[model samples]
Target: MEDFKELTKAEEQIMKELWEMERGFVKEIIDRLPKPKPAYNTVSTIVRILETKGFVTHESFGKSHQYSPKISKEEYKKGLTGKLLTNYFDNSPKSMLSYFLEENRLDVRELDEILSIIERNK
Candidate 1:
């Protein structure tokens, strides 16, 4: 989770592509993007930053470098969630759960399952 660090919006977008592809060269990433793709150098620079941040790694395929994620998407999200809980929710999972239950309408079945889990845990 510490490996996730944090990514800028641009970096997140690039990471999303890498996560989707599982692995890709710079050209593959650039090609799969939307109609108005970023410049090659721009993507290259960002990927380098991601590598430096420990979010990505590369393997040289002769002239080109193929990039892949160092952290899985799930692990990244877990790191982000842990930070969010500590920063915004006062490090209280109970408080966060209460906030979620209050803010959203939970279906009866879902509520029952959640209650059951709580009861079991207790």
Candidate 2:
């Protein structure tokens, strides 16, 4: 997959809704949002921007368009994690794990679970 453009906060919010719904019109997306929902035109504009960024595509039904995510959530997660690893940890998995361990304060059971996952993966 090609590198994806980083989504703005609003774009990410809209994309999350699209990912959940699989597809939706702008009003449908807004309806799913938390209270104090954005204006219809604002959501519509951001969805169009998402399309231009190649993260979403629309199927037109006469005057209305239903949008769907072009990039899966998993795909975006991988891309974002890669960027984070490279930028903050010098592309080092060990460094990333060390940071996560120190910052998250995992309990012994959680740490053991993580070790088990590593062992299984190995």
Please write out the lDDT profile of model 2 over residues 1-122, one tens digit for every residue. 23646888999999999999999999999999999999999999999999999999999999999999999999999998888888889999999888878898766788799899999999
Put down candidate 1 lDDT per residue, 1-122, tens digits, no spaces: 33448788999999999999999998899998887999999999999999998999999989889999998999889999998888889989988877877988666688799989999999
lDDT of each: 0.90, 0.91
Query: Could you tell me which residue pairs clash in candidate 1?
Result: none
User: What TM-score does each of the candidates earn?
Assistant: 0.80, 0.92
- Residue 26 in model 1: shift from native, Å? 0.9
**Regions more than 4 Å wrong, model 1:** 1-4, 105-122
Local error of candidate 1 at residue 60 (angstroms): 0.6
TM-score winner: 2
TM-score of 2: 0.92
